[model samples]
Target: MKKIKLIFSFILVLLVAISCTVEGINEDTALLGTESSANLNKIFDISTDNSGKVTITPTADGAVSFKVEYGHGTTSSVTVQPGASTTHVYPEGKYTVKITATSISGATTEQTFPLDVVFRAPENLAVTLNKSIHNLKVKAKADYAKSYLVYFGDVPNEVGTPLATDGEVSHDYAVAGTYNVKVVALSGGVAKTEKTTATIIYNAYGLPITYELATQNYGIGGTFGGISTAVVANPFPTGLNTSATVWKYTKTTGAETWSGSYSPLDSPLDFATGNKIKLLLYATEVGKSLNVELEWAVGGTPANGVAVLKVANTVANSWQELVFDFSTIAAIPANAKFTQLVFRYDDSAKGSGEVIYIDNIRLTN
Candidate 1:
């Protein structure tokens, strides 16, 4: 009986040894050899470009897959195969980048690196100014900027105000003068800025017009009949009191008329007496008979009272200021409020392909 008991104990010991060996093989373990540790630092490299784009390249012998996580809120993990690279774009801020490499045996090694991203300057920035009574409406556009800082240049020590892309802001100028405008683009906390200047003028007598104010409630080039008008740099010399740009009209073979219309005046223009219409005109030929007409509204509807005036171009190939006396032209109704202005060339008498320049059309009391 003692011999039988010893045999049973030997069998039990063999079974226990087998169970321990199986458990050791199946347990969760990690593979962190010297080669893997050294490769962990060498396999992963991170870099950023001027536009704040981040790229990560991983290269290791035993690495099977890679996982990268951006530290921002709700950011997802990026996975890539071994010997491959991944890229991501980040805002202007500092972030922690965590990268993990997984082996064939499900062993993972991770490393956290610091990344600093800075914002680039805004691109395609533009500003449009619209003038009104005692104020200027400014609109700005920047395609690449997330936010903006607008400076009206009205007061001192103005830190500026924040705006979004293609936003509009306004400033009130007490009198006519030159003012500075500055715009800044921001991403996260980093900023890049730009600036421009504006000149303001007030006309108290009549509806004022200038190159800068051409787009303010006004329309140009109507019924050209194959004529083209280009807004280009003023070709005239200084002291002509012309704005930076002038309207150059090129007539085609079938060109007949050129007209510019404005929005309805706030109040009816009283042209029954001493008012006159003035404009800067440049012609290529002398003695070109021209007919000028003003169309306006009566009681908020189109009126029949069209003021037609005749003028003779005595100066040839020179810039001259032309003033049409309303009193000398056809009689206008006492209640007529002038709004639209039309200029018709001598279609039957003028040559084809003739060019003319016009600027700064205004009215005077």
Candidate 2:
């Protein structure tokens, strides 16, 4: 009985010691760390710059260190001890900053806040010029620009206006002249400017060609003698103006034919509408009949595939203005390009070698 009682007492002492050790371990664990919502107050200094710089300073009770996360990169973080300030430079953007406060016992509490880094002025700005519908086409480009502004200088209406992101815009000048062009790239309302100058040329869209400009470009030629510059006859011929010069051609013996050929025009001649050729003629005899033919080119070869219209000189000897309506002839293609102008007079036996003055020969709408 005595030995059994001693064994039971030893077992009781062992159980009490084991219970006390477990309680001590529980107490130590409970004292390992503490967390409170007030730790958020540690974020005292938080600032950013338009150039993408951020500075942070955090302080908290019982905080051994801090982990600053910029939230731009998954593995981007910085570890700093308590009561210290750290800085990070980020790109211009909106971000969420996550700050983790770590206790001495390795416990951590995270606090996140919104961080905005504004944009700086755009960089590498450039401008290009083009033409559309007789207007100056301006296109601009830049790096890191949200939008652009174009100033077509000298025009009050378009001097300063916000433009699209693509930076493409068109402005028609009132006249042809040299003008300064300005382009500005904007980011967050900040601007970077560039300037250039462009000279604009006038385009005479479908305007009637003057007799001087025409004869110069097409060049007067044929079996007839070369061109001689002479003033128009007085009491001005029907189509002859006082200011215009006349083309004097004396007929040759062989065919009694004369013609003027034109180079391929800048814009192809449109014969769809008022396709008329007018000429002022002064012949030595009246009732002198002539064949005026219009020839067009197909595949670069002048062909008479369309009927040739000829208007006779019913009234002559004096200056008479005559019109040859190409529309009276067989249908030429609507957009046919006439390359050659032909004139033939049959009274060669009578009017042969007779000087015929041609003035103001022109093509019109």
Best by TM-score: 1
Q: How does each model score on lDDT? A: 0.64, 0.60
Candidate 2 TM-score versus the reference: 0.44
- Backbone clashes in model 2, listed as residue pairs: none
lDDT of 2 by residue, 1-365 (tens): 99999999999999999999999998988778454323553342333223455677766677788888877767668888877878776666777888887887788878887876766667778778885324788777777676677787866676576777775788887765557777877664444555566645344322143344322332333344332233333334444445355555555444323432222333444565457777777777766565666555545433663636555566555677778777665566555666555555653343345557666655666
Would you list the clashing residue pairs of candidate 1?
none
Error (Å) of candidate 2 at residue 142 is: 2.3
TM-score of each: 0.52, 0.44
Runs of candidate 2 exceeding 4 Å displacement: 34-120, 157-167, 173-175, 189-193, 199-201, 205-365
Residue 207's lDDT within candidate 1 is 51
Query: What does the lDDT read for residue 106 in candidate 1?
Result: 64
